[model samples]
Target: MGTKMIKSSQMNSWRRLDNSARIFPAASSVTTANVFRLSCVLREEVRPEALQQALSDVIHRFPAFNVRLRAGFFWYYFETNPNSPKVSREELYPCAPMNRRENEGFLFRVLYFGNRISLETYHALTDGTGALEFLKDLLCTYLTIVHPNIPLLSGWLDKPASPNAAVLEDGYNKIYKKARGFAPFTRRAYHLHGTPLPFTAIKVVHGVASTQKILAVAREHGVTVTAFLSSVLIWSIWQEELKGRPSWSPVAVSLPVNLRAIFDTNTALNFFECIGVGMQFNRSGITFEEILKVVSGQLAKELIKENLSQRNAYKVRLSRNPILRGFPLFIKNLVLRPSYRMGELTATTALSNLGRVELPKEYAAYAENFEFILSPTESNAIKCAVCSYGDRFTISFSSNIEQYHIQRAFFRYLTALGIELTLETNYFYDNKPVASPKGRKHKQ
Candidate 1:
């Protein structure tokens, strides 16, 4: 049976946007300086009926799912006129789907606009950590509706309603309050020469693996899988340069880290901070174990800092700064653009690992495979993607690195270590001439 419905007022600080629900500023133009990458994992066995039922059930549990912006703040509604909503999966295309209305925000976008149904969101509303929780509950509800025999673990289901604004904005407020003390991301970029080498990616998956299995393996190895697999990817690109794409040189690997869980705040906002992870592979002595150790150590330290929030807080502040507040968001994005960025790809591409998904267990079998794709930045050479089903890591990379040798070599190293991985190319933008778009601010 469906759970009780929630009133918008009862959901806290709920406001309404009286116009069509769409995320502008980011999508208003294709030439904006900020680049948001998209990730999608297509499961082989998605029961359509089950998925529909799941959406229907969660619609009440998360009233945010049925909402659309009337002005700027969030609002709750049992439903909107399908024809008047002006939102469909098409709006989220090339992006993941945005099925839930509450899931929509300034730094985020969610649209279910595909046949298989794709869930896409930009990096504004919240990071992957919050998104996963929403996904898990939605899937659980769906499974229950499809196969009633599966028992529901009520402990992990939706929380009861409340009216406090902080109740829904806890993490957001923490990050915002601490934003004044963080530092800016240091600039790091690699070069590209001649026709860029094209390395394709495949979506690989493993059936339900609890978060514990993946974390346990990492703990057992004394290193995070993100570190281990990232090490493997950096090496793979290095090898690719030696074997196939000879024209490329050494590059940096980028990783995006979510600070909410680490900071102990669970509010919803675009509250993620990214740090570029670089490795020195200029010589023959570098081993996967060594690189993994370094990467893992660095990430551990980055998360432990008390003042890291100040760095990214500036960007958010400037993005919504009240000074140029009147300028079209597009025009304002120019001044708001970061003068510097992360990820060293002189031969580099980014790697993003969202890590294992935690399911409440009773409905575990329903999840087939989970995958992630790193956000595509303005540069053609960057690509970051990762998703793990338990202890096994499914690694993927994005790059316009002119040399394939780096990636090829890294793949071989994993094979030698007996780490099972499936490499496939699911998407490519063709061999476009590689050139960094000149950075220019939008005119007000």
Candidate 2:
């Protein structure tokens, strides 16, 4: 990706502005807490060079480097920005590798494996589903190249640049329009406090199961998996509110929805919108099933809402600042930070379901399962990345919040649904290693 250098002046001169340009909530998709997840099954002898090649290949296939937060708004064009700085992984973010440690940059390449690999991303670029699709393709390509013998399962596996193929569904542009986001909110960017909760990967092996089993479990009770999961999380937050001696009385849960379903586009910089769907509940009558029912109702409406698309968010953001394209980012950041915090109130925690990363039928033989890791945000808020691969489910929890109990209680409740879970943690002490994803004996 080249430097994004387009200034507000150059962009504003797009004379054919649509009169139908709409406004939406300032805290729309792109800026509303960036997050992403990557899951792959790696071989034991993965080398850095191999990973670099994999990443480079991945980028070349889908080049949306032109997408960025410039002049306080998101923009996408094949033409590289002449005004933007040359962005290396480290230079692109002001935060440290472990500050809010919030930024999700290029590959960490930390875990080279024995049938295991995982990575995370900042929400600034795209939503959970978007990231999952990219990773699925990346792994599929990497696997085919590395282990050509393993046949891939059937689904839309393909060479994306092909002119005659149905690419990954991205129906957002038809619904949302590009508008300057006048985010009237402020979060201490990458600033965090409180100790991170201790976490580890939980392990369990099982025979492959159909997506029907997973989806059946979710929709059996009339709630989509996304709604059911969010409901469970919201209930957990309320438990934290009551059981823990926290100052806040209510807990929150937030989620990101792909606006592509609402409209369509191909560029993958950042194109989804976010909404926090939570309720303050007393611990007295708390139950995940009950919350699930309620959330199903809310989510049904959210998914169908005409205005929850990217264009709506942009419109809302631009309505707040008509001249948003004219200011420097720091100046815009200064102007917009406070308003962001004000809008951050809808939820305290987030549950990101990357939905299903539909892989082809052939690859399942050796690829094993996939898992997505949720990263800690600059805010001390807790979040989770829920992803399903084959029959197994992986949930990655952010470690920034004060209560680890909420996460523990969350999984405990999930298992009650007849699904087994294994836990794995990803932090380390100075230089000394705690464990590797493949730290155990290789299965299969």
Candidate 3:
């Protein structure tokens, strides 16, 4: 949105992607864009014109987000793109592969339909936390334009003419520590196999529940929120495991940890790492309580600041080595792509919890709830994303596979525990009435 030319001195201000983000570009292809989406569903229909202006205004606030990915000799870096993101109707599905060439070289896009606005971005550009911040500001500006005299949330939206330099920094470098050793090689976890959907179609199923009830259940189990849900997911998959399959493989879940709280950096860039939690079930049959205990203890140990910090720092130190930096882009991709893909072998699926989202009471009237959707990978066919707004918490299950056995099992388990769940989907034919776990389908 800012048309003023960047000064000559600032022309070299293009920043490198953070350590965690460095692999996304090399891993990306026409089939796998490595993109994720954040959506804010509202009570009223969306106004395209006002949304466009709001996007332009918000882009000026978060300048780090206005970037296009460029391939250097050895790495992919972000260059500033002053052009505004095109706001159009929601024609494609959520988390669709993004072709940067179609959007003025920008790695992100904004789309709106009936009553929802979606922000889809290549993971190389930013993480869910940054994308949510941008969405909050955009919503604030759009509401202020459409409804005059709306009270704006001060702390929620960043309004400076330009983002702080710290917001553009590579936090991994700032906190890098020399490598003590390489990461332990994890044995391949069991993969969920199913008939792939035709034409790369992704089926999204959202199950909403009261946050209070869910947390209370977590308290009853004496496990953290993420641990409780993760255990349920593991149980779901374990229930669907085929009889005669290898029994040695463990059920693993990848939990993405946001590093901002640990590192004390506020960059609107990729700043997170994932650690896998897994357990094996015996013939005796594993109970939910046992699974919760395993997930809770594993999560507690892995989330320690020092552990994650040292691991992430080591990765940055290794990537920045002088010798490794000299590899050509093509060769780098050849080596990094398979390595990164193999990392997925450690987990059957991933669960990224964005946690709670807060907004001024005034903004609640315009917005309903927020949904965080994680993109599925070729190896990991299904992934889950979680976010809470007001009293409602939404868990979005996105998968390239057509079956919902895992999702259904997980939701049924929740309902059995007395947590009411309302189901919603993006699939066209799924609109017809279908039997649900409960007597009826609750409103979305």
Candidate 4:
């Protein structure tokens, strides 16, 4: 049996978009899907009927995710979706553009393929943290239903029958303070140039490594995992693209900071900001250690709470301006679409580290691993997402370009450091296997 549905009259009819999410609806297109995916691989193959019932039970618990995107006279808003969203089998490439009408007016979809259960969402819905929470609950409920005889620990799987009001509050609006100045201006950064993949295809490559090995490497370099990975990314770009070239632009990597860590809100809506970390390599013979030092130092300064608060305040202030708010939807879209494109040029690529994911010991035995994937844009042809569960640390690269130079460079750098990688890709041409070199062996 599934949980009962909440009546439409019991919930708010509509609500305004959060500060960071306001631009997604206007800027979303086929080229830039503005979508992301979170998947968990289980020990056993998925049962579609059980997964569907699990979604039915868990969907009503999260009111923020049970809504649809609706266009308003002045701005886009989320309205309560009266129909239930159904889970489907994964057929198309991951993170493809979502069609609202075909999806029953839902902003997100639940998908399953073999042992993997994935949740792909539109950016306007929520940030990665919020989505992970939802996935956690759904996974817990599904396991409980499927393994009825297994004894599980209490409190780990327990959740409130209904969501608190905090889950829907816009944290940005709640923590807004008047800003004294603007965020530091950044010059346009280097962009990756490549031949686009035909037929709107996406190439996904995942490099699975041991978490302890990577953490030890980061400690050896005296940097956090994110800092270490970002530095490696910058170094990869420098060596592969701009090593011997004379260019004024720096190789910038956009890092999305989850504000919930710094702010005092638990809203499941979008409440994160992207801060750019960049390094210039005009001169030759720049070592990897030097790049690490520069990236670590810059991250230290940019991640200050005061700096992030002021940046968020500035965006909130701009959005609340009376004159800007008065513009009609179409006019706002015209200005916003181009503004979004320009913002994309400020980063050579994006690297989002979701940090570590935790699962209760009772449930851990049933899970194999977890992955996070980011959608790529035309300007930023490749983006990376990092996630770890238990001993498995996965770095996934999603690219639309036909080149694998950067991906190869990244994993090779790690392997050269003595960290073995189990590489997997979705590139299937001429009937070749998905996992290269076959047998799922480590790439040394």
Best by TM-score: 4
The TM-score-based order of candidates, best leading, equals: 4, 3, 2, 1
What tens-digit string does per-residue lDDT give for candidate 4 at 71-98?
Answer: 9899999888889989998877789997
Best by lDDT: 4
Best-to-worst lDDT order? 4, 3, 2, 1
The residue pairs found clashing in candidate 4 are none
> Could you tell me which residue pairs clash in candidate 3?
none
Q: What lDDT, from 0 to 1, does candidate 4 have?
A: 0.86
Ranked by TM-score, the better of candidates 1 and 3 is 3
Off by over 4 Å in 3: 1-12, 152-158, 179-185, 243-246, 428-431, 434-444
What's model 1's overall lDDT?
A: 0.46
Better of 2 and 3 by lDDT: 3
lDDT of 2 by residue, 1-444 (tens): 543343444433322111111111222232233334465664344444555556555554443322223222432112222332121221111111321212232322223444555544444444456566566666666666777686654544454432211122223433445644333222322212345432322222112234555577787778787887777766665655454233233454557676555555543434556655655454456566666766777677666655464335564446345576576545555555655555454456666777665666665555656666554443435667666666666666655444356666777666677656666543332344334343443111
Tens-digit lDDT string for candidate 1 (176-232):
553455444444434433343322221121222344454555666688677766666
Candidate with more favorable, higher TM-score: 2 or 4: 4
Error of 4 at 72 (Å): 0.8
Error at 333, model 4, angstroms: 0.8
RMSD in Å for candidate 4, one decimal? 4.0
Instruction: Name the TM-score of candidate 2.
Output: 0.67
